[model samples]
Target: GFAGNTIPIVAGSALLALRALEEDTKANGKITITRGDNPWVDKIYTLMDKVDEFIPTPERDTDKSFLMAIEDVFSITGRGTVATGRVERGSVKVGETIELVGLGNTRTTTVTGLEMFQKTLDESVAGDNVGVLLRGVQKTDIERGMVIAKPGTITPHTKFESQVYVLKKEEGGRHTPFFCGYQPQFYVRTT
Candidate 1:
């Protein structure tokens, strides 16, 4: 437990840290980043209002069937390979059958174990980040961006139609139109 050091720094310190992280990230990879000024700097109340307007409280659908996006995979000695990721929907428990779907393959596997933060769990629900030990799959076969989901729940595709929103120039965004094959970067847990 991180006790005193575990807590997060906020406001100015957090903003400064974001800038520092941008530089560190660029050095680690052949990527470019830009850290812009916070229009709400020193304006906590206004920022809070904007946050409330834009983002709402998260609602986890534990009642749905199991779903987890595979963020990583690794093998344990004698225990089989593990697919690790957050439960985007529903819940999963030990000994249940699951399907690994996405990235050009689909396979059925049993959940031999479930773990989080070095602790073994009987079940993990929506919003719970977990690592699932699986039987009959190789760590080399499963890749990131795949889903460990309930059987017949997910449909994988190489392309699909989607709606997009482009920000205006005033909000530090360009009003640029996208052309064919204009791929954009996405972060972790993108559905």
Candidate 2:
């Protein structure tokens, strides 16, 4: 739940950091960074009696097929394009054909490399934050919410409807029902 709130906010903010792997030979990688710079965070936590709780790692949703949410995308000057995010499920290896699906953009490319914490990896599974180098797609080809997965594993949709409950002011939620043309935020994995 912490990651659910943190990743999307940082993704939209200007604080997303893009780094090159030198010791880890990073072609590209994106990491979620939450700075406790908020003046209210301490008070909020102290009021809840959980002052020691920092950023909580999301529980890894281990599965059988490869899935990774695109947290960041950038290009290395001489090598190739890199996508970085935590693997949500399954595993992917170098040279495996993967599909980028989201935001009405679907493209196929081969995974040329994966690097995490500056070290190269042969494969990345759920819970590992890694940067994946691609063979064909350019940095401009993908977006933050697009997912990298085994080809045919996902289908992209342009629109979908979800049910949301409007809470009362007594419950610390909005007191009024949404008016016409109200748009709510949707947080799906990293995107």
Candidate 3:
């Protein structure tokens, strides 16, 4: 029962922390993050009517934007096609098929399921959640986050243009009002 005691304690702590975080997020709309930023969490900012965007500076300045490599692909029996991880721009919708482009190759698949934030939806657009599924293609062909899109819609590019912005901070270690024309890292999604 040693593991049980410790596990429940940890679980309870996590639940409480999550509750507090949800409350804080509701009241403030956004949390000032310091490390390990999940672009999805910030996606809410874009989804919500609150503000425009959150920009992060890249480690180095270069014309080529980073591409998420495909990790793995899955083919569920009778469930259709689905891809996991490496989410780029836009959203993946259930029953809506998209093209998988990368590695000097491209293919098409229909979305069967879109899972994000412990919630499953019929479709997922940009900033929806995470785990996306499609209809066509096989497990051997696709990989994780392989930049799914509509055929002929997008092409693999080493370089792209993006607009970056950051929240204005006040003098007392607080966020100031938002403004336009601010320069910051541009967090972009490719699909």
Candidate 2 segments exceeding 4 Å error: 1-63, 175-177
lDDT of 2: 0.76
Judge candidate 2 at residue 168 and give its lDDT.
Answer: 84
* Tens digit of per-residue lDDT, candidate 3, span 1-191: 35544332111244444555676678789655422353444443334423223224333322223223344466667775556665444444456656778655777666667777768877544333366666656677765445766556678765667654543464343365546985443333433
TM-score for all models, in order of appearance:
0.60, 0.64, 0.41
Candidate 2 lDDT over 108-136, as tens digits, reads 88999999999999988898999999997
Q: Against the correct fold, how does model 1 do in TM-score? A: 0.60
Q: What is candidate 1's lDDT per residue for 66-104, written digit by digit as tens? A: 999998889898888998888989998899999999877
Tell me the whole-model lDDT of each prediction, alpha carbons only.
Answer: 0.79, 0.76, 0.53
Better of 1 and 2 by lDDT: 1
Ranking of models by lDDT? 1, 2, 3
Screening candidate 2 with a backbone cut-off below 3 angstroms (N, C-alpha, C), the clashing residue pairs are 21-26, 24-118, 24-119
Q: Which ten residues in a row have the lowest lDDT in candidate 2?
A: 11-20
